[model samples]
Target: MAELRTEEEQVEALKRWWKENGLSLVAGVALAAAGVLGWNTWQGYQENQATAASMRYQQLVNLTAGNDLDEAQLPEARALVDEIVDEHGKTLYADLARLMDARLAVAQGDLAGARERLQSLADAGSDNYVAGLARLRLARLLVAEGDADQALNVLQSGVPEALAAQRAEVRGDAYHALERREEAATAWREALRLAATNEQPLYGVQLKLDNLGLESPDLEGSALETSSRDTTSHDNRGLDA
Candidate 1:
């Protein structure tokens, strides 16, 4: 009889312990399961969003290929670009779309629009590569517009290493426009060096130097050649005297 009584007491103790902890344990497990489900759902949604954005960006690219975007195509291209900007503005594609839009503006001879687009991208702390590209384009446009000083100022801020050669080239152009021949030569030389380091093809810099009749080696040699010529002329004058 004592053993039976002890068994009953033990059963009662177990029941009370379960009553105290069972609900809390069940609730904790349910919360954990919900959190896991929520996380998975969120991940799936983000993946889908990215895929959709990529498709849209590809469509934008297809519409703008190899043509000047004639009047009929222009509106469609612009609309597609705008849609990308509106829906995926935070994505890399949006920045690309903006860059494309700037190019379109240029093709249309809308210099002001292109300048505005490029300037905003450059000034807005955009992705480093895109911003560097915008800055380079803007500087070129400024040079084309006969604003070499402003072009120089625009490029004074540093660019990404990938763009260093292009930036140097543009700087050289601006300096040449300003008739700062020596500075222009220095910039072109730096540009050539950077291009070689990056394995990039640089054109026209050598030609520009040649046109200046100051192709570096000749620049040094020209002074000596001129002095020699002067000395010869002086000797001939002495003979004549």
Candidate 2:
């Protein structure tokens, strides 16, 4: 009889514990399942968005390919750029699109618009590579527009290490525009050295140095090696996208 009573007491204790914790346990499992479902849905949505953006970006590329920016081609290309930027601003595609848009602006002879777009991207600094590229291009435009001082200022900083060669090249251009031949030669030499280090092909830099009566004998093999890699290379600026 004592054993039966003890068994009944244990059963009652278990029942009470379940009554206290069962609801919370069920709620926790439901929450976990819901969380998983929500996460999957979010992932699916993100994948779909990425696919759409990539497709549209490809269309933009097709339109702008080969530098065939004719009257009919420019409008469609610019529209595609706007579409990608507006719909997918968070993606790298959008950043690339904005850069393409700047190019379109330049092609249309809208220098002010080009400057605005480049300035905006450079100021965004959202992506270091893209921002640095924007600054470089903008500096070139500034130098072309007789604003060499501003170009020099723009090239003073914010360029990425990967693009240090290009930055130096643009700085050289700005200095040349300002008739600072010695500084231009120095900057171009630094550019050649950096380009060699990074194995990035820089066109006409050696020629610029030659014009300035400067020579870098250490770059003889570098020039041949880097230029050899250039002919087979495709535009990889969109890889970030």
Candidate 3:
């Protein structure tokens, strides 16, 4: 009889304890499960968004791959660039699309628009490689626009080390534009050396050197002869992409 009474008292104690704590215990478990589910859903959503962006960017690349984009195709290509930037502005694809947008502006003979886009990217103050690319391209445009002084000013600040070859090349172009032949020769020589060290396949540097009455070992193969003419005519070829 004593044992039975002790067992009954213990059972009553457990029931009272559960009544006091069970609601909070159950709520805690429910909250944890919801947190896990929410995190999983968020991850899935991000994956889907990235996939969509990749597909769209690929489409843009295909459309703009060749130099023969017709008049009708140009508008379509620009629309894709806008769409990528609008939805995925923070993405690499968006940055590349902006680069393409700048090129499109050039094709349409909108030099001012090209400068605006390139300058925005250059001044974004990011350490991204794309920013370095932007600076280089912007310098090219500034030179093309007969703003060689401004181009030199833009290049006064540094670019990504990987882009040092192109930076030197552009400096040469700017100097060449300003009729500073000796400095252009010096910069072009440095560019050739750095290009070889960087293995970055810089084109037309040899031709520039040769034009300046300096000879460099051929660096760009068949491009050695043609690069000078292309750059002389276009002033925007050989962007480091």
- What's the TM-score of each model vs. the native? 0.69, 0.76, 0.73
lDDT (Cα, tens digit) per residue for candidate 1, span 13-124: 3354346556874565466657566756655665676688778877866776653356667778888889888987866667767877876777677888988998898887
List clash counts for every candidate, in order.
0, 0, 0
> What C-alpha lDDT, on a 0 to 100 scale, does residue 30 get in candidate 2?
60
What is candidate 2's TM-score against the reference?
A: 0.76
C-alpha displacement of 217 in model 3, angstroms?
9.8
How do these models rank on TM-score, best leading? 2, 3, 1
The numbered model that scores best in lDDT is 2
Candidate 2, residues 120-216, lDDT tens digits: the string is: 9999945666777778778878887889899889888888786788788788888888999988988887887887777666766666666677545
| Model 2 steric clash total | 0
Q: What C-alpha RMSD separates each model from the true structure?
A: 25.9, 20.7, 21.9
- lDDT at position 25, candidate 2: 49
Off by over 4 Å in 3: 1-39, 125-127, 215-241
Q: What is the lDDT of residue 93 in candidate 2?
A: 72
Clashing pairs in 2: none
lDDT tens digits, residue span 1-241, model 3: 2123222322343354356556864565466657566756655665677788778877876776655446677799899999998997765667767877887787777778888898887778233466777788788888877889999998887576767877999999999999999899889878877766655456666667777885554555343334444343334452311
